[model samples]
Target: MKVLVFLLLIITTITSKGWAQDCLGMTLKAGTSYEMSTFNAKDKPTGKISYQVKDVHKEGSSTVMDITAQFEDEKGKQRTPYVIHYTCTGNELIADLSGMMQSMQATAMKDAEMKLKSNKLVYPGKLSVGQKLSDGQMEAEMVSNGNTMMNMNMVMSNRQVESKAPITTPAGTFDTYKIKSDMSFESRVMGIPIRNSMQVVSYRVDSQIFDIKSETYNKNGKLMGYTLLTKAN
Candidate 1:
C-alpha cells in the first residue's frame, strides 16, 4: 500500500554514503548521529528517520560502518530500530539493502514470514555531471499461516549524476551532487496486483553518510513528498 511505497522511498534516500577517496571526502565516525524529517506534498510534517553510527572498522581493503536507524511517526511513536552496514572502498560506497526490510517488518508485514533478496546501492567516488550510475533491485515475499500474503518487487534505474549544487537544510548548507533516478514498484496482495512508480531527486554531500535532501515526484512530475536533513553531529 501507500505505507510500503513511503518506506521504500525513505530507505532509498537515507542509505547513501561516502569515504576518503574521489567518491568520498571523509570517513564515517562513531558516535555521530543524523536526523531527517519527512514532509507531505503540502509540506506538512509526517515522520522522521534517525541514524547513529555505532561502529567503524576496516575489513581487508574496505571500511565498514555499522549504523542503527529508527523511524518515528509525526506523533513521535517509533517503530523497531535496526542496524544497517555501509562498506566504502577506494572506488565506491555500497549500502546493504537487506537491512531495509526491517522497516516493512515493523509496519506493513508485521508478524509475517518474510524473505528478501536485493542488490546493494552503489555510489561511485568520482561523480560528474551526466555520469550514469548502476541500477538497484529488490524482491521480497511475505507469508503467514501457510498462505502467501504479499509479494513485492522494486527497481531503481536511470540513475545519473545531474549536476553539482549547494543545498541548505536544518543541518547546514552543503556542497552536494544532484542525482536523479526512477523507481518502480510491483506488489501482489491476495490475488490483486498493484503497481506504482516515481522519480527521485536527491542531494548528497561528499564524505557524508546521508542525503542532504530528497524529493519524490509522481509520473506526471507533481511533487509527492520530500525529506530533509534536520540535524547532524
Candidate 2:
C-alpha cells in the first residue's frame, strides 16, 4: 500500500517446513541489512530506503519477522525510522496492510492515530509461473487534532503471475517472477475526495523479501512510477 511508497517487501530468513524456491522469495536471515531506491516516472531519483531484520519468531501458524526501515531523501538525508512486521503463513508471504500502514504513520506523523482493516494477499508455495492470485480490500483512517484527517479504501484484485524472467539490478541479478495486479483507490484526504486506479507490477527474486522492481501505472496506462530493490545482502 501507501506506505510502500518507500518500498514494499516481505522479510524472513526462515523457510517453512514444506515451502521452498517456488512460493516465497528470500529466507530471512536476521540481522542482515538491505537497501532499495525509488524513482519517479521520469526515471529521476526520488529517495533511498533501507531495512534491517530486527528479529524473527514463530507464533503458532504464522512466522513473524520484524524489520526496521529507514528512509533518506535524494540528498541522502535521513528520515525517521519505521518498524514493520511481515507475517508468513508457513509457506508464502501475506500482505498485512494494517501493520504496514501503522508503522508508516507512526514514524511520519506525530500524535496521529491510524487504524487499518485489511484483507491480505497470500503468495502461494510452489509458485506456478502463470498462476493468478487475488488479494483483498483495505480501509484505513488517520485521525489527528480530534478530527478525521484521512480516509482511504483500496481494493486489489485481478492479480496474477504475469511472467518469469531474469532480472538485473544494482543489488544483483535474479531469476524473478513478474506479478501483476489491478488496484482501485478511493480516499478523502484533508476533506478532498480522490479516486484513482492503478496497475501494479512486481518482479520478485526467488526467496527474496522484496521485489527487485515494482511499478505503478495510471488508468491511462501511462507510467505513474516505480521502485527498485537496488541493494541487499
Candidate 3:
C-alpha cells in the first residue's frame, strides 16, 4: 500500500507540470529548465522534480521537445533521471505516456518488466472557462520471469477549465486557467485489487512550459497534497 501511494505521488508530481506547450505562440528552447516542489497534506515539504529541455526539433509540422527529469528528496538526495517527450502540432499539444513510463520504471519498478498501453494526454492551444477536455488513460502490467506480478490502471476524466486566475509561485506570478479533473487508479498486486481516487486542480499558463501550481484532494474534498513551480529558467 505504501509503495502504491508513493507511486501515485510521483505520478501526480509529473503530471502537474501540465505537459503542454504553447503551441502556435511560443517555442520551447533547448536548455530551458524548471523545478517543481511537492508537499504532503499537512503542507510538509516532501521532494522536488527538476526538468531541463534537452532537445527541440521539428517533425514535419509538429514541434517535438525532449526533456530530462530528475527527482530529489527534501534533503537534496537525487534519484535516477529520465527523459519525457511532448509534441505540439496545429492547435493542440500532446504528452507521450511512453516517456512517463520510463520514469516510472526507473523510479518505482526497477527489477520488473513493465508493458504499457496508454492514451496520451492532450491540451488545446486555447482554453476557455467551462470548456470540457478529453480523457486520458494508462494501463501497465509488471512481469517478473514468466509471471505477471502486478497490473495497474489509471484514468483521468471529467476534465474542464474552471476559470481564469492569477497564480503566484516562487517561480513568479502568471495568468492561468484553472482546470479540474477526476483521477482514479486501480491496481492488482498478487491478485489483490486496490483502488484509489482523487480530484486534481491545476493552474496552467498557456505560454509556460510548467504549471504554476496543482493541488490534489481526497473524495471528501480534503486537500491531500500539492506541487508548486519553484523555479524556471
Candidate 4:
C-alpha cells in the first residue's frame, strides 16, 4: 500500500510539469524554412520579400541549434547574412554566433546568456496574454558587454487558430500555442538611440508530439508572416 501511494505521487508531479509548459523541450532533428517581408516607411506594401531554409539541427535543452539565415534588401540584394548557434533551456533560449562570435565588440549571444543566468525578464509563472488565465507572462531582455541593454514583456493572447489536438508531422509531434505578443525595444546602434514597438502573434508548437506553427500579424491586423517549425528527429 505504501508503494502504491508513492507511485501515485510521482505520476501526479510529472503530469503537472508536463502541462505547465506551452512549448516543452524536445530532442529531435529538423529542417526549417522562413519568409520575411519588408515594408516601406509609409506602411505601403513594399512587394519585397525573401525566403530561406534557416538550418537543420537537433533541438532541445541539452541540444544546440545550428542556424544559417540570409536577408535581402529592397533591391533583392543579399544583406546582413548571419549564422547562429543556440540552445533552449526551458523557456529561456540563448544563441551564440558561430565562428568569430566574440570580437572587439561583444556578440549578441554573450548578452543572452548573461540575461538568462541573472533571471532579469524571465516570467516566473505560466505564460499568457493581456491578463489571461495564466500565472506568468513571457519576458525577454537584451544584453551586451555583460550589461543589460533592453528589457521587454511578452504577453500571449487568443486561442489556437488551427489544430486543436497536438499535431504530428514529419518534423515531430508537438502541442501548439497561438500567441499574440507586444514587444518594445531600446538600443543604441552606431551611437544612435533607437526605440521601436513590435506586435506579433506567434504559434509556439511543443515539438514533443507535434510540429508548431505561428502566423504573425501587424498592429493594423495585416498578415506579416508565418513560421512553421519542424523538430529535428
Q: How many backbone clashes does candidate 4 have?
A: 11
Candidates' lDDT values, in order? 0.79, 0.69, 0.78, 0.36
Q: Superposing all C-alpha atoms, what RMSD in Å does each candidate have to the true structure?
A: 3.9, 4.7, 4.4, 14.6
Model 4 scores what on Cα lDDT?
Answer: 0.36
Writing each residue's lDDT as its tens digit, candidate 2 over 94-168 gives 755555565557665658798776646566654667898867677888889889988877777887887888888
| TM values, all candidates | 0.88, 0.82, 0.89, 0.39
Which segments of model 3 are wrong by more than 4 Å? 1-22
The ten-residue window of minimal lDDT in model 2 covers 7-16
**Cα lDDT of model 1 by residue, 185-207, tens digit:** 88888969999988989888667
Off by over 4 Å in 2: 1-26, 103-109, 145-147, 190-192
Candidate 4 off by > 4 Å = 1-61, 72-76, 89-175, 189-192, 208-233
Cα deviation of 54, candidate 2, in Å: 0.5
- Model 3, range 55-112, lDDT digits (tens) per residue? 7777898888888888888899987787777888868878765555666677677889
